[model samples]
Target: MKKTVFACDACGYETHKWMGKCPRCSGWDTIKEYKIEKEETQVHEKPLIVNDEDFIEEKIVLGMAEMDRVLGGGLVSGSSILLGGDPGIGKTTLCFEIASKMVELGHNVLYISGEESLKQLSLRKKRLNLQKPFSMLTTNRLEDILHAIRETPYNLVVIDSIQSTYNTSLPMLPGSIGQIKDVSSNLIMEMKRADMAHIFIGHVTKEGVIAGPKILEHMVDTVLYFEGDKMLPYRLLRAIKNRFGPVDEVGIFQMSKQGLISVENPSQFFVSERSNIGSGSTLFPYITGSRPIILEVQAITPKTNFSIPKRISLGYDSNRLFIIIAILEKVLGKPFFDRDVYVNVTGGMKVNETAIDLAVAASILSSYKDINIGKNTCLFGEIGLTGEVRKVVNMELRLKECGRLGINRIFCPQGVEGVDSGVAGMEIIPLKNVKELNSLAFSK
Candidate 1:
């Protein structure tokens, strides 16, 4: 039987007919029609009892510490990974570097590019000075790419932008919702059958999400976002979803002429440019994945001439900035309502943890009062609406990173369990509330 249905591109909701707005995701005009061919299948396989030792999962180590760390140690064989990032964010460069390393490790790797010609790929390889040789294919035809994969016993396959690939049998253009879904399905099936690792490069939407259907992310074994400010040299590869490893793991890399170089000590690299005497800057220990990193949170509160004060933030949430400002205004009695508050995380790093709440408050207060919170001091704690400082996770880990950086003073929530106040020979100042934060920042 052949039937027609309409599907929502955002959430994959299907209906018998098209609708202007999707009831599931509320996206306007996202529903598109597609025909389905139904066929009957006979069950033939029987369930067999297998021991745990029957299958030993294998990993292909890329020999790059930063890349491996984000990939949960190494790329799991037969797993499909989707890597999304903004254009010129070094997505292709990172993949090429990984391919070269795999070749050096004596792995049969295939570099497929739908977006670039073979000559362009060659030019990039020469420009990046990749010494190792690997197989290269430049066609976007899904059938041809699958045929090549089926013919070769490859250890790894790199698809340079899945959106550019298409199946000719499909009556749609490449990058369309239907085309992306079907192409990814066929490619992933072949990858698993060959038991080889696959890395799919995907383009990100303007909203910073992977383009195409949301199901593409769900279909992959791992989802990694290669993120960094295009203006900055540093890039952060973060694992958003990983079936084989821990989620939220971050790998740091620096963009250079040689390509993406892995950053060994991100803590020192992020704070290397900090000024010793800055009123609006404060050091904060932020946890990304399982590791603790020290980041500089900067805020400037200048009196605004406009009636409504401006609240702007970069690399930090603006709404959270508004809440932090409101808390300071109500709790600490700071006149932030009249000042234009601006907050930023140095080194183009984006921080989402609320553990940085206290640091942000301190920086804003320091800027408002023109006080320096000492460059050697670090502060981290969540702030409540009642002006009380709350505890956060991984206190010891945060403290250790602070100690390693030679920071001697620390401010954190009071009475953290299983953690001594004095750690790493640094003076730990326990803070119970935001009032203590105000006194600590301004008293010095």
Candidate 2:
């Protein structure tokens, strides 16, 4: 018997009946009916496993410290990584840098381009000034690519983009959900069997999610996202999932005409243009993985004409902003019900840690009261629903970064013990509740 089910293509929500909109994802006209064909097949024995003596758990250095930092020291053999980013966001450029660096290390590398032709790749190579010799193939045929993989003696292989490749046996066109699922699954299996490292570039949807089924992210050993405005000079590589390294690892790069270069001092790059003394602006030390960088949090509040005040956040959570606003209104007797509030994290970096909660609250309060909290001051702490400020993890690292950046005054939550007051040439101020921060506001 054939099994049929209607599913939402966007989120994979299934139902026995079709509907105009998906109840789970709210996608309009995105539901499609697909049939599940059942067939019997013989089960095979497990493949040969490598012995401890034969297998090496070594990592291959990519020559770039920043790239290596993000990959948890370096790329591992037989590892599969999926990289996603918007168009012209320096995804291809960074991959070329990897290929060039790998080749420079006296390792053979194979580059398969399904998107760009030979001429286009050659032009890019010349523009990038890549001198190291490496193998290259421009084809979308999965079998041919697999055959090349089997024949080539390569330590590293890079597929320019998985969306551009398709298996001719599949009836669907390239980049379709079916083709991406089938092609990536096959390539991953082959790479694992061959014990060669492979990196696949994936395209992201308008919603900033990787294209194809959600399972695509689960099959890879690592999932990295290249983020930055195309108009900006900086690009950020963030690892959302890493089986070999720590997740949430980030690498900063400055895009120049010579290509992408690593930013040695990310803290300086983030707050270089910050105003010294401004209301609705506060310096914040945010920890991304093991590295701590200083970011500026800015907020603005204006009286709204609508019945429901609008809360807008850029590079921050809107819901969290609203929660902070509500906390201030309840604790400090400040009313934001009739105001339009906006919050932004400078440097185009998105921070989701609760350690920046106190900084966010301070910025919002400063904006509402039009008060500057003075210069050379930084803040970090988590705010509780009961108006209490809670201590965050890695307090020493956060304070050390602030001290390195010449920040003198630091406000943190109370009850944190074993902390030296002069650890970083900065004075640590402990606060018990949100009410204590009210002194930061300017008096009318």
Instruction: Give the best candidate by TM-score.
Output: 1
| RMSD to the hidden true structure, all candidates | 3.9, 4.8
Q: Compared with the true structure, what per-residue lDDT tens digits does model 1 show for residues 160-204?
A: 889999988655667877789999999998788789899999999
Off by over 4 Å in 1: 1-48, 416-425
Q: lDDT of candidate 1?
A: 0.88
Candidate 1 is scored at a TM of 0.89
lDDT of each: 0.88, 0.87
Please, what is the TM-score per model? 0.89, 0.88
Clashing pairs in 1: none
Q: Top model by lDDT, which number?
A: 1
Worst lDDT window (10 residues) for model 2?
416-425
> Could you tally the backbone clashes for each prediction?
0, 0
Global local distance difference test of model 2:
0.87
Q: In candidate 1, how many Å is residue 143 off?
A: 1.1
Tens digit of lDDT per residue, candidate 2, span 82-108? 999998898889999999998898888
